[model samples]
Target: MSLTRRGFLVGLPLLLAACSTRTTTTSTVSMISAYGPIADDRFPLPGLNARLIQPHLRRQEVDYESSHAKGSLVVDTPNKYLYYILGNNRAIRYGVGVGREGLALRGNAYVGRKAEWPSWTPTPNMLRRDPEANGPYRNGVPGGPNNPLGARALYLYRNGNDTMFRIHGTNQPQSIGLAMSSGCIRMLNHDIIDLYERVSSGARVLVIQA
Candidate 1:
């Protein structure tokens, strides 16, 4: 099931109210502290080299004034920013690599599922566009450090149908803030792992395209 723009707008208020009432016992400060510099052998994510990325593209907490309810995920395409609303006019912002011009998606969706080290299968359309690049992955690529989908994935859905779009980690950390994907939004592997742990399945996401 997919929702039209009108349908999503109609339900927006109700969704916001429901999300506002939910709260975690943990403090936002502590939560930020917990997500400290990512270092774990289990996933083997290499530390991000600051010199490789611009200062603005790095993950950081910022003062975000928005009408969206707490816990909602907002993607500002033009700014290359993804914000997780933390209430109190604050948000945890992560830099993202968005879809190249013609492939971008906008409007509302919810995270229908989540995965760790998710598999990647190139769609038929993707394979057709770049056979040499995507054809071999038609059967799917096993998840790992080198896989394009990286360490975590949050699958987006609208009206219960898979959008075939995702907020997932990428093997190429330097791609953050660039418009260079088929459609999926890409995050740093470390950042995605942190976001995956914080966001719940079914959380609302709003994408603003400019």
Candidate 2:
């Protein structure tokens, strides 16, 4: 639960413990306090301008209507929202930026692996689509503030094979709530860090196609 790297959650779905959630109705946690500058991180991060983000796009606990088990994740692609189902009809909602029109992942998958400040390398497809943009990073980028993967990454898998899809933090915080990624979902640095702690490696995920 500490933001440490976790091995690929091999074998059964429940290989890791269920994630604990915060759902107290009287909780006093505020937006500024949660999204403030993170100076103590390995690579210090600047505070986000919450005012620039739409209220609905900000991270918050909400009354979720879902039949999925607690700890399951649901990505509402069209709405640009990711729901961390905590059951009891509640969930923590975070804004997400998804892949463009035909590039989003769909159906079921699970967190096969989780990493803090994970390394990032462009795929062949990415290179082909925009060599001028991705060619430079073909050698890959080390994990850091400037890294495209940002502070954390959750690798998605299906049938025990890495699907090459991810739910990760991004250096472009402004991209949240937009459709501009390759195929993986993108979250804010602080939000993904918060999620990385709460979600276990084997947590199930469902990405609803747009």
Candidate 3:
């Protein structure tokens, strides 16, 4: 499929209840489809021109050790790196697209929830800033390969309230290593999926000012 600047976003089941011989039960369940490998064609294949990821300067030292701090997510906005703190000092670091100059932030938060193939609802702020992006998409865009959230989302909350930002996947892989998103941290689909699998709800996330 052709890559659209707005695409790259891509998501359930139910259960019933019954009783024994003469009984009746009712239940509700949802199933998650096992996601397949992200097709190379679905993304801009790895190439020299593609945005570089986990570049040397941003990587923790090769011999980095995993500390108790492992399993953390670090957003080094200045360097455009998001590190998935692996146990010991090592981490799987990925390049990210952060907010622009005036939009950058410094703070700490945690992942309050995680979603695969997440739907997106442009915030009121977003709609006010981009009227053309308004209209039917205001409430929320359904999750799909064409969603701007790419393939996943890890919602960030501070003091248990949504910061309205996320550590999420991006279809704009080219935007990685740059500042382009609307204050959310954007990662490659493969990278976010990998990190998503490793992190859990309530994982500590630190966004250090670069």
Candidate 4:
């Protein structure tokens, strides 16, 4: 079978996903895939550059002792990490890009909704902040690999009210682990896809400022 460029890059990682400790092989491979192009994504995510995921930032289980209950999602804005609470002082940590407005959108919220290859509509503030860049897309960008919200998105809400905040995959993978002008938490497309599978609807999300 002739593998397309996307297929070759995407398949290479799955073959290596089994290389780590057997217990962690699954997570390891998934993490590796996070940096490689995706041929199976609903919208054809182009994947990420190898160097984008620094060793320290790659998805892996870490000793994260938190008061948050299991199955919750936590965003560590200052450290640029997102944790999916797995209890037992352990969690799956994924590095993310936090916008300044995303930092301002702190406190408790829940995943009121989730979507795959979700469309993106920039908030008014986002437009005002960079009209030149966001103006043409005012009508909203459709769900696809090139969209701002890449493969998956988790919408944040409180008490059934829309908080207008989101955790989603990004077309701009290079922005991971940095602050940007947008108003959401952005992850590598593959990382978001991984997160989307692990999180359930209505999972609580806590964004920590410090």
Q: lDDT winner among the candidates?
A: 2
Candidate 1 achieves a global lDDT of 0.74
What tens-digit string does per-residue lDDT give for candidate 1 at 132-169? 98987889999888789988999999999999999999
Residue range 1-210, candidate 2, lDDT tens digits:
232221111011111112223333322236665576777778877777676877677777766656788998998888788888878977778889999988899999999999989999998999999999999999999999889998999999999999988999999989999999999999998889888888998999998874
RMSD of each: 9.9, 8.0, 16.4, 7.5
> Which whole-number lDDT from 0 to 100 does residue 190 have in model 2?
85
- The TM-score leader among the candidates is 2
**Candidate 4 C-alpha lDDT tens digits along 1-210:** 111221211111111111111123234444444556666655555546555466555666665656778999988787787888878766767779897743357889999999998988878887887899889999998898688888889999999998888999887777888888366899877778778888999899988785
> Between prediction 1 and prediction 4, which has the larger lDDT?
1
The lDDT values for all models are 0.74, 0.80, 0.63, 0.72
- Give stretches of model 4 more than 4 Å off: 1-37, 46-52, 101-103
Per-residue alpha-carbon lDDT of candidate 3 for residues 1-210, written as tens digits (9 for 90 to 100): 222211111111111121001112211110011112444433432322221432331212122333438788777687676767655444545668899767655688999999988899988887888879665688788876678898789999989898998988877777888897888998877667657777899999988774
Better of 2 and 3 by lDDT: 2
Residue 44, candidate 4: Cα error in Å is: 3.4
Pairs of residues clashing in candidate 2: none
Q: Each candidate's TM vs. the true structure? A: 0.81, 0.85, 0.70, 0.80
Worst 10 residues of 1 by lDDT: 5-14
Q: Candidate 2 — what's its lDDT?
A: 0.80
Positional deviation of 119 in candidate 4, in angstroms? Answer: 0.9
